[model samples]
Target: MNVELRYLRALVAVVDAETFTDAAIELGTSQAAVSRSIAALEQALGLRILQRTTRSFTPTPVGERIIAHARRVLDELALLERVAGDHGSELRVGYAWSALGRRTIALQRQWEELHPDVSLVWVQSNAPSGGLADGSADVAVRRRPLTEGRFTSTPIGAEARFAALAASDTLARRRVLRMADFAGRTIAVDRRTGTTSEELWPEESRPAGFRPVQGVDEWLTLISTGQALGMSSEATAAQNPRPGVAYRPVRDAPPIEVFLACWRDDPSPLVADFIRLARAAYLPG
Candidate 1:
């Protein structure tokens, strides 16, 4: 079975991205081109590698087997290229806005100290939408897991949601907060793009009268100025606990789990090292 490297690479991109459009964007190609590559690869292999539905692409048993081998082959190829060039160049790292916490910063510093040869370039993003797709980032720190199975994820830590309120707000005096405490009160939140906040929130644990704002900064600003109460991660509150704002733990709320995700099909040693450091720094002993 003669499979071109391009086809294998495309398959890996699609699997990592979970969608044809995302895969195409990551590969700097068109969706039609990505689809054609996958089709040709499947035809040559005489076996279906992916189970495609309207929502996402799932790897078939054979494809899963192929992916393991493909990752090893791709990694070896990347190592050869690195050896041929400068092996001690810059290592680009990406993180979502919510990941700028003490733990993340400490980990980065530790990694840099351990590998002084590697220069670390940090990129901050609100979401992973184009970070990996553009090839600008080698590793990504996200609050949610990569469900598409195209990225290998390592569970790092968990963050509980807290109700952040201005010091003048009546809720600020409360020792503990509940969903009913937010009833009829203006609550700020990060607006959803494709996915709804309802999906992210637990069905029974959602706060009544909760409303989303345009962005995280806006939400923080509103809460800090006494205009509204907002929801924020414990990590966020810990990092930016303003004098006017107080963080009270939310009772009966869902916590978001943090993960270190890397392109499963891409073989980059820097990404692997970052993932290792993240696990060591954040994962509970």
Candidate 2:
């Protein structure tokens, strides 16, 4: 039950090499050490696993069965190590709403093909810093400039802004909408996670009032019921399409800048690489 893998390995080497001296040479150990390893293996298991004569080394019937089982166990343990190693090397990326939208799958696939040593995992948190503020994520895909001093960020790409409207709203009929058109409407705003603010409009043209929401679900739900109009990075339109809401281009609005955020100090080793890979992923197609 407590046998060592090295002991089992030594036994297999002796069988395959046909002699303890040969196995010792292959293993870069002295013949006495190989002999001791096989003896220790037998003693640990309370069984004689080898039939040895002066000039011949063979396996007893039980030795044959144990050897097969040892090979299987070693192979399975090697596989387990790989699975564990992959999980340890994983990078967890947090986001509030959309994770690169249309680019998400491509990013994953390309990162895998280019660097198979690490894996990426996505977690969603509705905070403006994504999950970076909490311990839920190691790095994040954020749309706004992160003001938190604990984090540093780099711009990856910019996505056009879009207005989220009730499907039945008049603006939905327009091929493209403008900031002026949203005047006089209630704005559903997620101050923590979203990039939109009344500052995007002139003081006189801002929405009538702001209805605060904690997350995208509430923002979308309120928009669906025509309770408010909202704006988000273009990725949100592609990543989350509500059944009762429509997305229209905010032609005059400034594009939302997407950023890769990480701890200002002691960031993960993978963070910079992830940022580079992400920037490349969003390159114009």
Candidate with maximal lDDT: 2
Whole-model lDDT per candidate? 0.69, 0.80
Compute each candidate's TM-score over C-alphas.
0.62, 0.67
Q: What shift in Å separates residue 262 of candidate 1 from its native position after superposition?
A: 1.7
Q: Which ten residues in a row have the lowest lDDT in candidate 1?
A: 191-200
lDDT for model 2 comes to 0.80
TM-score of 1: 0.62
lDDT of 1 at 48: 91
Candidate 2 per-residue C-alpha lDDT over 79-173 given as tens digits, one digit per residue, 9 for 90 to 100: 45434533586877989888999899988997788678778889886544565533456788988778756578899999999999999998889
Candidate 1 runs further than 4 Å off: 1-88, 148-150, 191-196, 199-210
**Deviation of model 1 at 139, angstroms:** 1.2
What residue runs in model 2 are displaced by over 4 Å at the alpha carbon? Answer: 1-87
Q: How accurate is candidate 1 locally (lDDT)?
A: 0.69
